[model samples]
Target: MLLTTAAVMSALVLLASGGAWAFTGWASGRLDRIDPFGALGDRPEDGPRGALTFLLVGADDRSGLTREELDRLNLGRDEGGARTDTMMLVHLNRERDAISVVALPRDSWVTIPGHGPAKINAAYSFGGPQLAVQTVERATGVRIDHYAEVNFLGFLRVVDALGGVRICLPEPISDPRSGLQLPAGTHVVDGAGALAYVRTRSTAGGDLDRIDRQQRFISALLEAATDTRTLSDPARFTAFSETVLQTVTVDDGLTGGALLELGNQLRSVSMDDVTFTTVPAAQTDFTAPTGESAVLWDTEAARELFGRISRDEPLAEPSPPAAAQAGGAAEEPAQAAPELIVPPADITVQVRNGAGIQGLGARADEELRAAGFNVPVPADNWVGGTVEQTVVRHAAHRADSARTVAAALPGSRLERAGELGDGVEVVLGPDYQGVRAVEAAAPDSAGSGGIQAATATDNVCA
Candidate 1:
């Protein structure tokens, strides 16, 4: 997300100034000479005035790497040119208050313009940026206004030029596959280390976990890069710019002039204002038709999130605190109630008895019904464990539902119960107690079983 901010700001400033245009021409000429993706073609049509979009690609190529460094990084064959490992589309509102960057996993199964359904990253390899852009546009229905690709070598150079970036590690991270080793704590990572950190995917969560770490690192990098110390130092700024400019390949529209203007526009924005989140994904082991096991994107949430960005909107904020903290509060009589949208009944509310007592399910059901949900039937069997807590289950598609359920049961143990087909399910734990309801109907189908639809219609635009 921080990278998105930096990338966008860089584009705005560089493109608005004539220098950016010239730099882009030069960059394009260089890329043309390489022609790694084959012959370059005419550019996409620039849309009428509206939101500005940028597609940031992180390539895995290490052609610029030295033999010693390649051995150090454990990099295999020289990939010749670049292969995009990460693809993110960032949409900035015309007003610039809000920004959204949607990350598309490299392994996602998508239909390419000419190449049928293939790994999303293959589009870049098959036809280069033009094909990659077309593929993403068709997949998400979001038009990309510009593009930028950062090779691994370039990323390292920029990181080194920025004097390294500071990153916080909650636990020791070691990935022999990526040659990244760090102890638990805050560590300043140089360009090579940062690249390894961002590219690591051998941990428990795999690529998803790697993306989360990358997002955090990007946030830290943005904060560091925008610091007065870095920005005010001409030597540092120029070095950073040159390192970035060399490693980065941008569309004709993102010339140096545009980047300068963008930087000026975003001068007032702070690091805290920028946020990053991945498109919701299901923890699935399903094999693609190609027989490769891969995590699948939750199509519903992914589409909605991307649609918002296409319209230049900020992500929906986290659920309100009051709603989350309302658990177990005594009901007030004849008092004016704040207007808040109640999550649909279809949202599964799992009642778990954390109290380690009998009749907990009954009590939980009563509490849930009073909270405006139609309580589902309490399971006959008890969910026994030392870690006593209530849990909720909704399809990965029902992100809103998950948020609502989590808010309703604040401070309780919450774990993603994986993907569900339709409705939400609340399983009462043995510790649960209070009034009981036999079965609660889903909110959407009036009595059918399915996850609840999103209740709020607020535009994603911040």
Candidate 2:
């Protein structure tokens, strides 16, 4: 879902800065236009303002591909219907200083306009992008400001134009259906490989697993596009901008100036500032009333998430309110919850190598120390041997303290360990990608159909 959005965001920045002058004008003229939200007819009076939320749709429809290209890419004819394999609700904060990209599981059960309950993606299949936007608004109770659409072939060209994207895999994968065959490590993937990576769903976690991979793919793509080598090279920037504009279709509102505004707002933000997560959902095999298997969103949690977005509040934690004048009521000051806030200087951490990769422990020690944690315990091999997921063990009384430490190292789990005398012990596992601040907390925690987040800065293998 974000593949198109990420590419467009980078292009918009280049356009806004006049970095691709000739290409920008030419590509801007060639951009495909769509009335994505026009069918909805009217905007709600209570719709959110100040912030912008875009409904990014990735269509599996292959309508515009040439016969030879389709055959070459293994894409069959268009089935006379449109279905989005991926949908994401992207939110830009009021200040445009941060971004939260929420992936919407296409299989999630929701109501379609003029139709009863069905898989959310079916809305697009039934009526196109307009109905898809309507269904999302009705289901989440959050108003969407804009829409963007891209097809499979367009995605391929864009990635190829940007050279290639690098992705890290913890284990080898060979999915025949998607044509993605790769070893267990990092590789720079070309267009076809990128498509296969995101399309394959035979992995362990099912659609959920695919969703995670897609999110990671978006981050990696953005990081690659923003690299100094790509940015400084005019030829690379021109090719990227041209391919992206030709590839993506946006609602009428995202004109060149509007795009420049968006790009300017986000100019200073880094990949580290952007966060990606999925909409809370539970996997289910139960048949819907429409006779289709669907993913069920945790209704209670989903509602709360939309509510926060409606008020323009940050989803992770309390946001500072607008300040009031001297005679007026002062806005409540936002603060990190006690459970989430732990000063790096307050605790000591022991680094152990469980990843089997040589010098992993020593690297972790250096990273933790730079992050302000006291790494008094020298890096050593873990007695427990090689593990899969990273774990942070701490004394019983310092569970919250451990969580704080884990926050600094995103993706690591917190556990109880009386063996660690005072602080926490970080055993870097095979899954240990790197050290970076974990994303903000979600409305619901993991394992409960809540949002799972990953930082764009972390190159962790998905």
Candidate 3:
């Protein structure tokens, strides 16, 4: 899904600026082209003039690889038809300031226009690119402005061209079928190893787990491809872009000149402005009408997700509409939701007994530990007046970590305390609810409360 989009976005980054712009104008002609929309008369209407949405797909078709290549790569028998290994819906806001890459679960149980009920990936397999586009548009209700597909094989070449990518697993991962085996540590993986790493499917969460890996992988890849040294080197940029373009096939409209224009528009997008997430799934083991297992998107949540994109609204909670201006209204600037980049295991918190209930601080400390945060020091008494609302206090620099702490404690308020220094304090109050079962995700508060996003950089205020 994002694997190819990562390459495309990274390519735009390299082509937008630097001396490589003209070179990409020439190289764009080398990109594989397809007319995926010509026959679709019922396409979704064009959205905001300045906004753009791209459907990026990665094909796992093994039919094209030679016998020797398959043997070396451990690719199984060809499935005969084209099925998307991964799919992502990429939205670029009108301002070109933020990008959201939403990974579409290939196993999603969705209706394929004329094909009745089946897994979403089957759309590509049954009707080629046209049906895939139509199916996604029908399901998500968001007009896709452009389309691009990539062969997963290209991922290897690009990674190798960039001299491998560095990734650290907080835990070990092993998949014999894909031949991806790695211990819990940081390592620079080459092309084949990178391929195996992405294609591995031994995780407990199934596709959900793979999506997380893909997110981290794409983020890491983008970081590597956009590294200062890589961009500064013409020879390196050319090779990397060539390898990427070779693997991608876009719709007829995305021409060489169009790509150059896109490059310029996206030049301002920083790593922090880009976010990788998945469509919220209500059920992962849904039994479809066809009696096959499939992922089912939360109908309401998925609709709201797309509707927000359609309105050109920020993925984060929408700021209260600017009080009607004197003469005219103002645009609601994009606010990315707060996302937890650092793992809970890496964060430390000190519980303070402000509630005065017996062993309140100790109970809070134990809950936080079970929730995955580190608490090295024992609980302490707050000694202040009786507290009402629980508060997570930390220095300004640790706001992200503080958010994690606050998020772990439902209804807790996050605050900055100058005296706290490097220490983070969670003062349990009388109103303290039990610790929230957490995940490595942006806090998706119920209702219209502004959406908080977790990003690697916490890119705020441009």
**Candidate 2 worst ten-residue window by lDDT:** 328-337
**Candidate 2 lDDT over residue span 29-65, tens digit each:** 7777778766576554454556888888877767666
Candidate 2 vs 3: which has more lDDT: 3
Error of 3 at 231 (Å): 1.0
Q: In order, how many clashes per candidate?
A: 47, 0, 9
- On lDDT, the leading prediction is 3
- Predict model 2's lDDT versus the native: 0.66
Candidate 1 wrongly placed segments (more than 4 Å): 1-48, 282-284, 319-462
Better of 1 and 3 by lDDT: 3
Instruction: Please provide TM-scores, in order, for all candidate models, with all chains considered together.
Output: 0.66, 0.70, 0.72
Q: Positional deviation of 393 in candidate 3, in angstroms?
A: 16
Please list the C-alpha lDDT of all candidates, in the order they appear. Answer: 0.55, 0.66, 0.67
Cα lDDT of model 3 by residue, 108-165, tens digit = 8888999888888888888888888899999888898888877756767778989988
TM-score between candidate 1 and the true structure:
0.66
lDDT (Cα, tens digit) per residue for candidate 1, span 283-317 = 34558888987657657666666666765656655
Q: How close is candidate 2 to the true structure, as a TM-score?
A: 0.70
